[model samples]
Target chain A: MDYFRQAWAIAWKDILSELRTRQMISSVLLFCLLVMVIFSFTFDPGAEYVSELVPGILWVAFCFAGTLGLERSWGAEQENRAVDGLLLSPMDRSAIFLGKALGNLVFMLAVELVTFPLAAVLFGVSFLDVWGKVALVAVLATAGFMAVGTLLSAITVNTKLREILLPILLFPILVPVILAAVKSTGSLLQGEGWEGISSWVKLLAAFDVIFITVAILTFEYVVEE
Target chain B: MEPSLRRNLLGLATFMMIEAAIFMIFIWAPTEQVMGIVQRIFYFHVSCGMTTFLAFFIVFLASILYLWKKDKKWDIVAHASAELGVLFCTLVLLSGPIWARPIWGTWWTWDARLTTSLVLWLIYVAYLMLRSASRGSERRTRFAAVFGIVGFVDVPLVYLSIHWWRTIHPVVIKPSGIGLAPPMLYTFLVSWAAITILYFYLLGLRIRIGKLSEGVEELKAIQYSGV
Candidate 1:
């Protein structure tokens, strides 16, 4: 209970800061919207195959925008040596990791919330029927993404190539999450119900469990000097 | 034995073994009835593939030890092994398409093994890049160790996810365990053994280079400090 409270407190700190400035969320949201517009131009949005392309486009947008958000999320801590303060806090290092990951998850999901409906409208697909299923897939994939992203973000924050290094280190390991998410979302959008997407859901769930565990275990090493 | 003598012996052994393996592959092993001459690339390709996996496993083990022991030696081993892993992985990726273009009639198909190797290649190349980017810090070593472990742990998951994804794409190559003839099997064994030795030899060379650089850095530090 204490650990959960500590983690929540740290998450709330980030959330509250974002609420005050709205800098990270707004930029990430706008970036996601731009991705939608650019991708929409590449293919005929009215074409029959547009539905098939929507999931991949949606995931690409999420991942790219999520990468941006991740950089800022850690980059914020770098300012004023704030991460040092976090380190000096009484909470466990893994708690800090959990908190940061949770904060990232919330921010990315918020971006997804606005982007999903906008994507449906722009691409001329009615995700209205499968909205819940799509949301489920998004949440699962984003959770795993955040878990890994948070860890990698910490690792990259200290590197010379801080911004570029995250994606290079991140995307390969993230292939499974992206593949599973896109598959699940594609199927769900096609009106394939729970039974059709069950396997992908399992993969996403397994990714979430494995990576969150690994991140929690290794977070201490990344943050410690 | 002296370190130089040991290294020379290892180098000699690797050279002789590789020569013997090449001779066996080209002259001794019977050509496949189906794929013909192109099938021979399979000997080195598969051997390199195995060596790639072995190199990565070394990175994983050394990474865990690095974190556990907090030893610079372990970090050097992990970094050196990751570089060698990327090298072997590149060989696998290159030879794969060379064999595939003739046999499968495509330069690439999203086959499970092909996709997994590509992803693995990307992962370790990123590992090496991370090491280079974080050149001079102890923190860099720790971060690299963390990624080393994370990257390796992701490999099987990457493979499993890709294998499942390949079910939707019509699998171009069924990977039905090519039935090796007696001589073909012997040649493959010899090639595999030779490549494994080459990996170790290359790894030894890399580790020596890493230690020498560390020594140079220490000497420079001492000179600056007037110690």
Candidate 2:
């Protein structure tokens, strides 16, 4: 119970920081909107291609936006030296992972909230048809990406080339996650019945479980000096 | 294991010569009842592909052992094997397109084998980058081990690709499967044995060099630290 409270406290710290500054929100929102606009230039908005490309384009934007937010979370921690203070606290280190991951999830979801609806408008896709499945895919994928990214961010925090290194290390492991997410979302959008999306859901769920467990266990060594 | 001194003496250079001879023999070795000299590529191409799989398997084993023991020696073995695996896999990729060009009538297709090889290449490229990017010795070793273990996921995916997708590559030798002709089968088995020896010899030499370098570094550190 206390662990949950500690995790919540850390998460709330991030939320309050974002609320005060709006740094994460504005950049991610603007970046996602820009990606969508750039994509619109190349691919026609009125054609049937919108339905086909919406899932891929939205996920790509979310992925890039998520990276932006994640970098801010750690970057802010570095500037304030808050991670050292947090590490000095009595709470379990894994809780730090859970806290930051939950915090990242919230920020990403907030950005996605705007990106998804706006994408629907710009791309001429119906949000009413398969919004549930789309949301489910986002949740699973976001969790998996955050779990691995949190671990890699800590690992690379001390490195010279961290900004570039984190994504290179994170992307290959998360390939399976991204592939499964894109496939499942495309199926849902194409109106393939629930059965078609089930396998990919399983893939994403399995990846999330494996990665989250491994990250929690190994994170101690990552943060240790 | 007893050192196979005599066996190791017959290195990959010798076996490769034999492989080349057998390959040329395909032109003079007589045409098959069905597929012609074009079919001869089956021997070298398939054997190289199998040897690459064997190298990667060694990498996976060495990686697991390195993590378990926390020993630098195992890390060297893993790193060397992975480099060799990439080399063999690259050969398989190159030779593949040439054969496919004539037979499949295109340079490349999105076949299971081709996609699997490309993904496998990308994963190890990431692995090499991870090792290179780390600063400290211990840090690089640990990161390499983790990447090595995770990278094995691509290995199984590559091996089972034909079954998972209807690959254009033939699945000639399944364990519970049918047999092959005497001439082609005999030459292939011989070549496989030769290539296996070559992989071990190369891996052993690389590991030895790595240990020597580590030793020199340790001596230099002690000399400078005044310990």
CAPRI grade, predicted model 2: acceptable
* Stretches > 4 Å off in candidate 2: A1-5, B1-35, B153-170, B173-180
lDDT of 2 by residue, A1-225 (tens): 999899889989999989999977998899999998888888765886678888888888877777767777787888878879989999999898899988988888888878888987888877678888888888998998898787777766656677777777776666667777777788887788779888677777877887788777666656655
Candidate 1 lDDT, A70-182, residue by residue in tens: 99898999999999999999999999999999999988898899988888888888888988888888899999999999999998988999999999999999999999999
Off by over 4 Å in 1: B167-178
Worst 10 residues of 1 chain A by lDDT: A36-45
**Candidate number with greatest TM-score:** 1
In candidate 1, which residue pairs clash?
A: none
TM-score result, candidate 1:
0.97
Query: Where is the poorest 10-residue window by lDDT in model 2 chain A?
Result: A216-225
Q: What is the TM-score of chain A alone in each candidate?
A: 0.98, 0.96
How is the predicted docking of candidate 1 categorized under the CAPRI scheme?
high
Q: Give the top-scoring candidate (lDDT).
A: 1
